[model samples]
Target: ALYYYADNPQRPYDPEKAKQMLSAAGVSNLTLKYLIRAGDEVDEQTAVLVQQQLAQAGITANLQKVDPSQEWDMTIAGDYDISVNYWTNDILDPDQKTTFVLGHDSNNNYMTNYKNDAVKDLVAKARLELDPKKREQMYIDLQKMAKDDVNWIDLYYSPYINVARKNIDNFHQNPLGRFFLEDTVKN
Candidate 1:
């Protein structure tokens, strides 16, 4: 798809390239800082991995391990150039990403100050559109924009829980919406 292709589907990681971009934008030798939870195993490991990756690219990244209690507050105070976190969608829609993904948004969904006008327009169009084809195209456009913009590097989606009891009958799951016990009554 055009969206996936535009994101430089096969570019190797390079920090010099990243540095040059930052320099051009008046952000040089950017002492990129990161705030992570002190005891979370995933956060701990990821911070170490990023520290190594950025080092390969010639970027000085500072990792500050903070208490989980202070994580949100520190991030809100702009205490980091990057922050490691997680999210679970309430609904599977692009609009949900808009309020959270675009630069320093109220949702502070992504702390990276990445902003794209085209993406905003596309999201707006997608929201108002009822046509499936048009809506899908708009999303494709926005996703492509994200790839090129390098605003956020979507790593991976975690697994969700789906289990059934031994006596349970015909259980179904709606991936895009929440599950409620009341909605799971058996015949």
Candidate 2:
């Protein structure tokens, strides 16, 4: 699961390297109990793929199906071994994805219970910058920091499509996969 690199071609999959890292970290007889929403096909597919991949390195993953209604509570209560879930952001801001989700007092910090002062500070500083370039750079730095920490792994971005009549005006879908009816007008 950790060997995956979709964008970075430089980081090729090396089973030997992974095995060595696991051994160095004093890992042995590794088995992951992967949790998945019972009715979620995507989560099931991802879990299966990850299980198969991890098996190459002798890591056995036991898939556990959980009720979707109780899944969030389980994750929030930290009762999961490894949860496969997605976060939906309300707006197009890096803070929604990184800081608000992974920061302290966040509702969705399920994986590692991760909280870093540096990340919080970066997000805070970025929020204050009026210069677009400066703000972008600050978030970029935050992204790099999060990647280096390797606390969270994003699998994929699901596509969302919005349909509207040709005559509709001011119809635009934000990156957050949402649009407001108030902004639209018949032209």
Candidate whose TM-score is highest:
2
Q: Which lDDT value does model 2 have at 38?
A: 95
What lDDT does the true structure give each of the candidates?
A: 0.70, 0.72
* Backbone clashes, each candidate: 1, 0
Q: Which tens-of-lDDT digit does each residue in 107-150 have in candidate 2?
A: 64544577778887777787777887777777667766667776
Candidate 2: list runs displaced more than 4 Å: 1-12, 108-112, 162-174, 179-187
Cα error, residue 48 of model 1, in Å, equals: 0.3
Worst lDDT run of 10 residues, candidate 2, spans 1-10
- What tens digits encode model 1's per-residue C-alpha lDDT throughout 1-187? 2122243454567877877877788874656778889999999898889888887766777888889879878876667777877776677665676657852366454656566777766667777988877777777766666777777675556667787867766566666546655556544
Which segments of model 1 are wrong by more than 4 Å?
A: 1-11, 15-30, 103-105, 161-187
- In terms of lDDT, the best-performing candidate is 2
TM-score of each: 0.73, 0.78
Error of 1 at 147 (Å): 2.1
